[model samples]
Target: MIEIKNLSKIYKDEFLYRNFNCAFEENKVNVILGSSGSGKTTLFRMMLGLEKYEAGQILGFNHKKIAVVFQEDRLVEWMNVYDNVAFVLKSSVEKQEMDKLINKALELVELIDYVNYSVKDLSGGMQRRVVLARAIVCRDSILFMDEPFKGLDDELRLRIITRLKVHWRENRTTVFLITHSQQEGMLLGDIIYKLAEKPVKFYKI
Candidate 1:
C-alpha cells in the first residue's frame, strides 16, 4: 500500500495541499478525480517523486519500478511506433525479448498494423495508444496515468478502457490514475478518490 501523511504544497501564493492524508491500495486501479488546478497533477508528481512536497511522508514508493503516462503523448517524433516502445526496454532487455514485448504491447493496443509508422504520422488517439503501449511494455510494479484518455472520442475511450481493464486483471499492477471524468472513474476505478476544494478534501467512492 502507498500512504501519504501530512502532505503539503504551495504554488505561488496558494495552498494546494495542507496537511493532506490518503492511502492507495495495492494491485488495484485507484482514481483521483478533481477539476483543473485542484492539484491532482501535483499530487501524482509528488507520489512519483517527480516533485517535492513542503512537508510530508510518502511511504511504499522507494525501490519499486514505476511507469507513467503523462497528459501529453511525449513520444519521440523521429521514432516509429515499434521503436518508440522498444526505446524504453533497450537498456534492459535483449533484442529478441524486446521485440517480443513490443509486439505483445502493440497487439494489446490494436496498433500492430501500424508498427512501422512514425509517431508523428499517427492520429491523436493512435499516439495515445502508443503511449499506453509504451507504459504497459515496461511491466512495472506501479503505474501512474494523468488524463490518459484526453483527446479520444467516447467510443475509442471506452474501447481503450476495456483493454486497460484486461491488462490490469492480468498484471495486477498498482495503478494510480487522475482525471476529472466521473464516467471514467465508474469505468476504470476499483477505488475512487474525489479531491474537493482546498485545503484538499479526499473522499472515497
Candidate 2:
C-alpha cells in the first residue's frame, strides 16, 4: 500500500492540501477524479518528487521504479515511436529483449505499424499512445498518468483502455491515473478517489 499521511501543502498562502491523508492499493488502478484546481496534479507532482510539500509523508515508494505519462506528451519529437519507447529502458537490456518489450507495448497501444514514424509526424492521440507505450514497457514500475487519453477519439480510447486493463492485470503494475471524466474513472479505476475543495477531501467510490 502507498500512504499519504498528514500531508500539507500551501501555495501562495492558499491551502492546497492541509493535513490530508489517503492510501492507494498496490497493483491496482487507483483513479483520482477531480475538477480543475482541485490539487490532483499537485498530488501527483509531490508523489513523483517533482514538487515539495510543507509537511507530509508519502510512504511505500522508496527505491521503487516509477513511470509517468504527464499531462503533456513529453516525447522526443525527433524520435520514432519504437525508439521513443525504447529510450526509457535501461542500457543493460539486450537488443533482443528491448525489441520484444517495445514491440509488445506498441501492439498494446495499437501503434505497432507506426513504430518507425517520428513522433512529430504522428497525431496528438498517437503521440499520447507513444507516451503510454513507453510507460508500460517498464514492466515492473508503477504507472502514473494524467489525462492519458485526452486527445484520442472515443472508439480508440476505449479500445486502448481495454487493452491496458488486460496489460495491467498481467503485469500487476500499480497504476495511479487522474481524469475528470466519470466514464474514464469507472472504466479504468479499480478504486476511484474523488478530490474536492480546499484542503482536498477524498470520497472513495
Q: Tens-digit lDDT track for model 2 on 7-28? A: 9999989888999999899999
Q: Against the hidden true structure, what lDDT does model 2 obtain?
A: 0.90
Query: Which lDDT values do the candidates have, in the order given?
Result: 0.90, 0.90
Local error of candidate 2 at 139, Å? 2.3
Clashes of 1: 0
| Clash total of candidate 2 | 0
Where model 1 places Cα greater than 4 Å from the true spot, the runs are: none
Candidate 2 stretches greater than 4 Å from native: none
